[model samples]
Target chain A: MFEGYTLAELGSIFAMQGFAGLILFSVFVLMALGLAIIFGQMGVINMAHGEFMILGAYITYFTSNFFLNYLPALFSVYFFVAMILAFVGAGALGMLVEWGMIRHLYRRPLDTLLATWGLSLMLQQFYRSVFGAREVGVELPQWLIGSLPVTDVIEVPINGLFVMALTLLITVAVAVLMYRSRWGKQVRAVMQNRVMAGAVGIDTEKVDRYTFGIGCGIAGVAGSAFTMVGSTGPTSGQLYIVDTFLVVVFGGAQSLLGTIASAFVISQAQSTMEFFLSGSMAKVLTLLAVVGILMLRPQGLFVLKVRR
Target chain B: MRSGNIFLKRNEVVFVVILSALLLVVFPMALDSFRLNLVGKYLTYAFVALGLVLCWGNAGILSLGQGIFFGLGGYGMAMFLKLEASSPEHTAIQSTPGIPDFMDWNQITELPAFWLPFHSLTLTIVAILVVPAVFAWIIGVAMFKRRVGGVYFAIITQAIAAILTILIVGQQGYTGGINGITDLRTLKGWDIRTDFAKEVLYFVNVALLLGCLLLAQFVRRSKYGRILVAIRDKEDRVRFSGYDVSNFKIFIFCFASVLAAIGGAMFTLQVGFMSPSFVGIVPSIEMVIYCAVGGRLSLFGAVYGTLFVNYAKTIFSESFPELWLFAMGALFIGVVMAFPNGLAGLWQAYAQPWFDRIGQRGAPRPISPAPISPTAAPAERRT
Candidate 1:
């Protein structure tokens, strides 16, 4: 595949593709982080995770328009505000879903997949009906626009850099929130043994509702970041669901570090291969490799050794 | 009066009689050919739903990628039909006279090596059945032997569906891409496009469905069936009791794939085309919903559920296209949350007790032959 390129050209090519892969990896981490939390921690399959992310995207879209219309002077800074609102909006909805739907399905993990799938469909239709079916892209502020020319062959887009920074910041925050905080401990305790946690006077239901909400909030933030790189459509969420699920599952559902690692590996492989193979073929090969590996290690890349 | 073999209980005999009459006699006499054909299309999905009843509901293997098998079977049949339809004389104007139109359009002068076996009808039929079974067996062994199941199995199967769809749609030159295999004219020179042929095909579809239904019923009744139920509830216990639990799961998964393939082949014959659209995640999940709505545990309910949901989809999508998805979505949530067992469960819970009471009143003796346990009685009466 590298037969025709000079060493310098190949170096630049890898550099450029690797940067592109980082943007994709950022999005995957954002999506898969929330999923790993819900699925790994709670043992619930949220098939509507993608839709929750889209809710964040739509929230960002509206925030941008709102800023452009009502607060013209602050239009450039609307993204931060949009991200916050997206988190709240998606988080609230996620809590509502947990309370209304997911709580009833704690015993039946498989049915949650179906129910959430139905939720995803309804959410897609809701997006289509409200936002129209055409793909929507948020306007970028002047600072976030344009690219930096690192070399004659390698140019890095500013928005991609911003999204990557945002991903890193959020990932660190989530890691801290999951690992160090008192609430995090309570949540982990609930997940480890619900009855024992309740016996210790921890309110398991409240922890569940909040955990689901926070996961969804992070997905919302991810969706907000997604607008920086690509167009969002009503059906865009469905496209990412399988890939994100693969990332989480491949990373060992219980480990936060595993999710990030799997996402990086998958996105890098896919984008680098895209430079050589057709885009769909690259995706096929990447997913096939992941699935093959998963077959061998069904517990995923990392396993949490916990007694039943 | 209990039958000696226990193949069909007293009420089960009546249920079978009524269901057969409805499919074979009432439907044909009542509906026009187009409507009947639509029902036939719905019935094709019933094969998939029936398979789900056994695989998912009984054995607790919920494969979201049944569409892969369906597509394999449909495409297998479609390849044969396409080759027959694209005979050299019919495509004399094209650059490649003997190849499928899509291939000729893509500048290929010859058929691919994989397309060679599909040239013969017998080979096509065999491929349709065996390919999906082999594929399912591979997936089942790889996953089940590792004890990877539940949501994990469902997700993996869904990923497989996504992969297959991408492969089919991506390889347009060989697989007909997104437009899929179309313009299928005849099957062994029978002119399948004709009205008479369509009517015959509907009958053929019904016969195949009925045959599959009986086979599924047999599996559900056999000792293996009880073991499957046992495995579903407590797989480790079954394994510790000296059963190769994975083998039972693999067998049922393979069995389900074969049933789905049969439906796919019949769908190609009746619908006259095959596409990646039906082989994707969305359609595969929708097929599960059909099984769910009908009552996953009940074979007859699966058939009825397929018909009911498809019928509503057609009617609702045609009239209020926007609302169809909402209705379908509600159906999924409603079916799962409110009534996990589905329409049959509703019937059993609400209606059967009333019928039993009326029957008891009609009988002079207070059910003296056998004191029916309320819990076990309804289940046995249905099948």
Candidate 2:
């Protein structure tokens, strides 16, 4: 397949696809982080996680429009503001869902999957009604556009770089918050033993609500980042839901670091294969590989041994 | 005393009779040919629901990839139909004279290796039944043997569905791609597009569905069925009690997949075509909702639930398209949250008691003498 391409051209092509894969990796990491927290820590399969991210995407779209019309001078900086709003908007809705639906379903994890799937459907319809059926893309500021010429053959898109940077920042923030913060400790405690955590006066319910909220907040931020690389639609979230779930499940649901690593591996494999195969074929192959590996190692890439 | 029929209780026999009457006589007599054909299409989905009733509700394995089996079966039948439809004279205008139109469109002159066996009707029928069962067995063995159940199993099955959809859509030459295998005209020289053919197919579909329903009912009544329920509730206990839990799960999963595949083949025969749209995540999950709404545990309820939900969907989507989704979403939430048992549970709880009172005045009690002890009776016969 590479018989005609020069060695340098092949090198640059690999470099280009690798960078593209990094962008996908960034998106995967952002989406899977939220899922790991909810599915891993809480044992709640929020099928609506993608919808929540789409909600953030829609929120960002609205924010960008608002900034463009009312505060054009501050438009370049609007992304940061939009990201924050997306987080809060998605987080509040997440908490609301948790209180209303998920709390009752913690005992029946499978039922939670079904119920949230219903929630996702409603949310998709809600987005369609509000935003129209067509996809909406956010306009990037002058600063986030264009490409940086790393070499004659390898030019990296600035938006891709910015999204990667944002992903790294958010991943670090989530890691620190999950490990170093007092709330993170409580969340982990509640996850480990609800009865014991409650007996120790840890406010397990509060932790659960907040944990769910934070996870959703991250999904919203993912949606915000997603607007950089691609357009957003009501059903676009559905496209990512299965892939994001696989990433989390493949990473070993409980491990945040594992999520990042698995996301990188999957995204790279997919992006690199896309160059050689049709897009659908690449996706089919990637997913087939993931499912096969999962069948062999159901605990995923990273295992945190704990007694059931 | 035990019932005259070993498989069915007395009330169940009546239930079966009424259901058969509804499908076989009442529907055919009442509805127009087009509408009857539409009902036949919906009944194909009931095969999936019936399968779910056993594997998911009874055995406690929720496979979100039933669409794969359905699509496989549909495509298997479709291959044969497409081959027949694409006889050399039918496509003399195309670059390729004897191959499927899609294959000619893709510039392929010869048939693919896999498409060869589908040329023979016997092999096609055999393939439709055996292929899905093999696929399901592979998945069941891979997951159940590894002790992967609940959400992981659901996610993996869903992923498989997604993969199959992508594969089908990607290999357009082989699988007919996203548009799917269409323009299917006949089944063994019978013009299936005709009204008369549709009516015949509808009866055939109903007959097959009743057969599957009875088969499912027998499985639910057997000792294996009891063990399946036990595995659902306390898998480890069943495992410790010298039962091979994985094998039980594999059997039910394979059973469900075959049921779904049978539905799929019938669907192709009735609908005149099959598409990837029906082989994807959305359709697969919607099939689950059909089973859920019917009362996942009740086989008869699954059939009714499928009919009812599909009816509502058609009516709602036609009249108020936007509201259809909201209604479906609410149905899922309501069924899961408020009434976990679905329509059957509602009937059993509220309506059956009243009917039983009327029946008791006119006839003797319907249930057999408590064979396993009165206290264990409720648990034993929950399905």
Candidate 1: residue A186 Cα off by (Å): 0.8
Clashes of each: 0, 0
Q: Model 1 chain A, poorest ten-residue lDDT window?
A: A104-113
| C-alpha lDDT of residue A153 in model 1 | 80
| Candidate 2's TM-score on the B chain | 0.95
- CAPRI verdict (incorrect, acceptable, medium, high) for model 1: medium
User: Which candidate number has the best DockQ?
Assistant: 2
lDDT of 1 by residue, B1-383 (tens): 44564655566667678888999999999999899989999999999999999998888889999999989989999999999999999999999898999999888888999999988999999999999999999999999999999889999999999999998888889999999999999999999888889999999999899888988888888899989988987887899999999999999999999999999999999999999999999999999999999888888889999999999999998899998888888899999999888887887788777888888889988875432311132331111
Question: How close is every model to the real structure, measured as TM-score?
Answer: 0.97, 0.97
Query: lDDT tens string, model 2, B85-104?
Result: 99999999998798999998
Question: What TM-score number comes out for model 1?
Answer: 0.97
Alpha-carbon shift of residue B230 in model 1 (angstroms): 0.3
